[model samples]
Target: MDRFVFAGRTCVITGAASGIGAALALHLARREALLFLVDRDAGGLARVAAQAKAAGARDVATEVVDLADGGDRLDLAAAVEARFGGTDLLINNAGVTLSGSFEQVSMDDYDWLMEINLRAVVRTTKAFLPQLLARPGAHLVNLSSLFGLVAPPRQVAYATSKFAVRGFSEALRHELAGRQVGVTVVHPGGVRTNIATSARLSGPDLDGQQAAAAKAFSEKALTMPPEEAARQIVAAVESRKPRLVISKEAKAGDLLARLIPGHYWNVIARVLPKGL
Candidate 1:
């Protein structure tokens, strides 16, 4: 099959306000893609829309909606369909992080993270699946994470959500085999994003430790630039690659998980930076 093209294609991206999502918006814009950007931060969403327009997007639309809310997800999908007519590409990039061990985290917070990270992706994909089927050569992208590959301490909620994304994307790819639509599940390493700093801390007294760990992880492990990650993702989309793992750290983790599925974390803990 021929590779996917971005120019003039209608692409819907969630979490487009900042980080990898914003960088992706700009990257696709330079390719002249029609963009529908979504995020909860109105101000940041507006800024990205303006930048997307300036970067040469054929057309740009912005939606400020909380993906964790089912009503908002449905409403956003309807609005996108109404305005864009149809979507050629759907990128489920919105995600949140929860810090603390499983016991330290509350069920409410865990559910909240799941709502945005996994449920939102599933719901949005369901909403747009018809459009993707109707359009020839359409594609879907889900942003999983390095945590998706490796299960580590203090990241139970995040790992669960990301692992679910990875599973969903892989299964969907199998189901869509030989179809016009394509699926790509992304496993990005610590690209410098605010997910760490802005992570919701669960335990009451563990705030200081969690905060320090988040800071350390962001500083030491978040080595790749969002722009670079965006470039790699766009390239993966063009090739219709089923899986794209970004950054050396993520790649290493993926390999380790496969090599020692029973105890990868044993090695990971030893090599991982302190406080993380």
Candidate 2:
């Protein structure tokens, strides 16, 4: 397989323990990039690191840091700089999920989700972005969701965070355009990652609703494999694409949102089953 010219780059991927992060790390390893894998789960990060090294990473390492903690993210950057000098690619892939009515959402749940989903992106980017700018043609990848493009019924906090991510990515891209940094905002549709299975749903009496949504979600959706999504994202950066939609469904939804504006929500509304 012909790989992209990522051979000499130092790639830092957050949430690298599993899901798309692990897959991206694996793909980049095949392209011979140096990998700095970050995740709160130490054991999972170790597994990803071993896979990257086995696959073909020039050098592979791991950092166990909870991105939701601002102080932890700072320490993580210090460790990265201490170990690897500087990064050529920084991917903000760490995220969490929440589902409930905005009014029913607890303050703790709201704050925790915000910290992980939105604030961590800001913190990690601020920490690693300088290293990226110092190098020529550096890259930054922010993993926004299809929900970020359009609002849905249940995911109140998650939607707000993704919206922030989408806006931040665009703004950062423009700010860094004339400079050497490149920013690619990724919007992936339903991916066959364990995120849904592991997601935390809130609301005092919403457990039944959550279970029903989970069931419906698994049924009607065809989640593309994480490997395929990872490939699309890496390819986008190599090709200098500013915005990337990982699945055909995502692309269609994005286009529809653009074409009819508010009507996109109507489509989603119609698609929703009773419980979800």
Q: In angstroms, how far off is 262's CA in candidate 2?
A: 2.3
Give TM per candidate: 0.97, 0.93
lDDT of 1 by residue, 66-157 (tens): 98887535666677778888899999999999877899899999999999999999999998898899899999999999989998888899
Best by lDDT: 1
Model 2: residues with Cα > 4 Å off, grouped in runs: 1-4, 205-207, 272-276
| Model 2 TM-score (2 dp) | 0.93
Shift of residue 17 alpha carbon in model 1, Å: 0.4
**RMSD of model 1, in Å?**
1.2
Top-scoring candidate (TM-score)? 1
Residues 143-247 of candidate 2 have per-residue lDDT tens digits of 999878877777788889998999999999999878878889999987877676566777655448765666567556636988999999999989878999878
How many pairs collide in each candidate, listed in order? 0, 0
What C-alpha lDDT values do all the predictions have? 0.92, 0.84
Over all chains combined, what TM-score does candidate 1 have? 0.97
User: Cα lDDT for residue 42, model 2?
Assistant: 96
Candidate 1 Cα lDDT to native: 0.92
